[model samples]
Target chain A: MSKVKIESEKCKGCYLCIEVCPKKCLEVSKEFNKKGYHPVEFVNDKECTGCGFCYQICPEVCIEVYK
Target chain B: MNKILSRPESLTLIQHSYCPGCGHGIIHRIIAECIDELGVREKTIGIAPVGCAVFAYDYFNFDVTEAAHGRPPAVATGIKRVLPDRVVFTYQGDGDLAAIGTNETVHAANRSENITVIFVNNAVYGMTGGQMAPTTIEKQKTATTPFGRDIKRDGYPLKVCELLAATGGAVYLERVAVNNIKNIMKTRKAIKKAFQNQIDNKGFSLVEVLSQCPVNWGMTPKESVKWMDDVFVKHFPLGVYKDI
Candidate 1:
């Protein structure tokens, strides 16, 4: 299975990763960070391909993917 | 498995003040990665410009100096000349580099100063609220050109790479974008090469990044990326404009 880690504090909540993810395993959290933006969460690690597309598309460089 | 992605050590830990999805953060990371990978962080001296990236000094982990508006190239030239052993570079935006600093840029390139320039061409005066910039495409709507830029009045977009290529002082000049996975990777490689050229004592080198300004462009981040690829790319035409 693949896993994704997010540094919530670094996330700007642009959500570009969710839009580009092929697996749809990520979702925006209801909680807000210090910046008051909803950080994204990995909802289903089992569905992740670890393709690193999310890692590539993140402008803030806040996401990590592990296979 | 190992850590796949993390903030580069060359970048400070402070959260960026850039708007969400701004390209400045990505570009900053790329520059930091290049410096780290090249093991030149300690020797790198970055000159921050007077635009959205004015706060670059706060984000970079190494020594950083702020230059006057549209004067990074000139400032970088002075620093690099004095400290030839250090890795000197300038981080500038479209408004600062191509508009007000046009003369500085051309003359610096003409002098073949051994400095790396990372020019972010987002097509608007971002810090000043989306005013028309020299890099703004003709017919693009900006605060100063609300009805779309007229070619006759505004002139055409300034092709920095092409302009610098003609000066012969620029030994390496490439334009890259950061909208997709492949392009982002290419941008990283391009940045590294530009810095490497400076390290090798080559003449002036510049990497013009065709970035997206979502807030200024009045579009979503995705739409801004799309427009950059579809419309902006057509005008700029990415590739190595000059290489030696």
Candidate 2:
């Protein structure tokens, strides 16, 4: 399964990654990070193509992509 | 399957200081990725401007130096002149480039200094509380321009790429945006080319990135990007202004 790991501690909750994810595998977690922002959580149930679009668009470089 | 993407090796472990959804981090990553791809990180020297990216030296792994407000091009020119072998580039924001550094920018480009320029044009003076920059679009609301920028009084936004393209020394100039995935990819390509031009001794090359200042723009990161697509691009269209 393709997946992207998000560094929750580093995420600023911009959601740009979620906007660019083709697989709909990324969602905002209810819990806030150390920075007081809602971090993204990967939804493993969905199949990810590992397009890396989220990786390219993430301003904080929080996502790491794997296929 | 293994890892498909990760942080560029040219970047440090320090987290970016830019606000969420700001484009500096993204641009910084793109530049780092390009330097890594070109295998020039070891010899690369970045000239950091006095703006939101003042801490650019901390983010980039290679050698980086700070320059006065809007003086990066001048600083980069001296560095490149002194060490012709090292890859030198300057990263400046709209206020630093088109405003305070306008003369420096014009002369550097006019002289065709063998240095790469990464011009981030978010239209406002982000670090200074969203003051009206020279590149701020017509009638755009900025901190100084509460009633919106008066085109009759303030004049049209300066098109840096187009302006520099007319100079004889500049060999390449491209304006790009980072609002969406396609534009982000295109921006990456443009940045790589700018670096490549310097390495090839092809004279001055500038890549004007239409970055997003979500916090300063008083909009969500999402809305800022959308506004860039809907309104910003209308004022400053993207594409190569010059290539020779």
Candidate 3:
């Protein structure tokens, strides 16, 4: 199984990851973290291909993808 | 995996936007090489500032954030505080750091933010028309300072390393130039140390690199190096100012 993890606190809300995700599995969650910013969340892991696009696009290095 | 001259995995294939003989390219390559050598390409987050290098996000293979002019330090602060395990760095120019963003740069150093700063001082502003910068030397003519920088009117060149060293928060501070082969090697070492400091959680670290601006300085590539060797170094002496 492939999974994506978001370090919510580190997320700067750049949305580059969301834009780069080919599968469109990630979205800015309604819930805000300690930074008071809405971080991204993976709504469906099944759609994730583990392409690492999101991992690469995340400017804050807040995302990690494991296959 | 650490090889000199070999391109770093963190750098993208696209060529930089800097002009021919520009020092920004050299500084960028040294930083990318250092990141590759440290094997932190995967964990490093770079904050791109608004300047000639504003498009740095396209050049680095690693994750990158684009911050407004002189705001890289503030953005890096937010990123590093949250992702303490990851390495965060900012590539800023003299116009951005010593001029408009002086407050952000100073406070970030005063707070000892756990991050690395690569300060490129090319004496004059490159992105915006050739203009006088905070680090511009006396008697240097720019588009704005047509009659040469007047000492009484224009302030002295800002020595970033000297200013940052006064703050106890900074763990490592060095001023280096990339005008020659020997100096390039030293600049690489200083860059590596700044990144190492971040990894060791040693607080803020900065390497002020004296760079050449042939396009803005109105000099040829070769002339730029000579100018750096003759005039730039005299004002911004190269050396490690603080190491802890």
TM-score of chain A of each: 0.96, 0.91, 0.93
Candidates 1 and 3: which is better by TM-score?
1
lDDT of 3 at B104: 96
Error of 1 at B6 (Å): 1.1
Superposed model 1: Cα runs more than 4 Å off:
none
**TM of each candidate vs. truth:** 0.96, 0.98, 0.77
Q: Model 2 off-target regions past 4 Å?
A: none
Model 2 per-residue lDDT tens digits across residues B52-160: 9999999999999999888999899899999999999999998899999999999999999999999999999988799999999888999999999998998889999
Better model by TM-score: candidate 1 vs candidate 2: 2
Q: Summarize candidate 3's per-residue lDDT along B121-220 as a digit string, tens digits.
A: 9999999988999888999999999999998998788888999889878889999987766687798899998999899889999999988887788887
Q: Ranking under DockQ, best-scoring first?
A: 2, 1, 3
Report iRMS values in order: 1.6, 0.7, 14.3
The better candidate by DockQ, 1 or 2, is 2
Question: In model 3, which runs have C-alpha deviations exceeding 4 angstroms?
Answer: A1-67, B1-4
- Model 2 chain B is weakest, by summed lDDT over 10 consecutive residues, at B68-77
Best-fitting candidate, measured by TM-score? Answer: 2
Question: All models, DockQ values?
Answer: 0.66, 0.88, 0.02
Q: Quantify all predictions' global Cα lDDT against the true fold.
A: 0.90, 0.93, 0.83
Residue pairs with colliding backbones in model 2 are none
Over A7-48, each residue of candidate 3 has an lDDT whose tens digit, in order, gives 777665546566557889899799998867788898887887
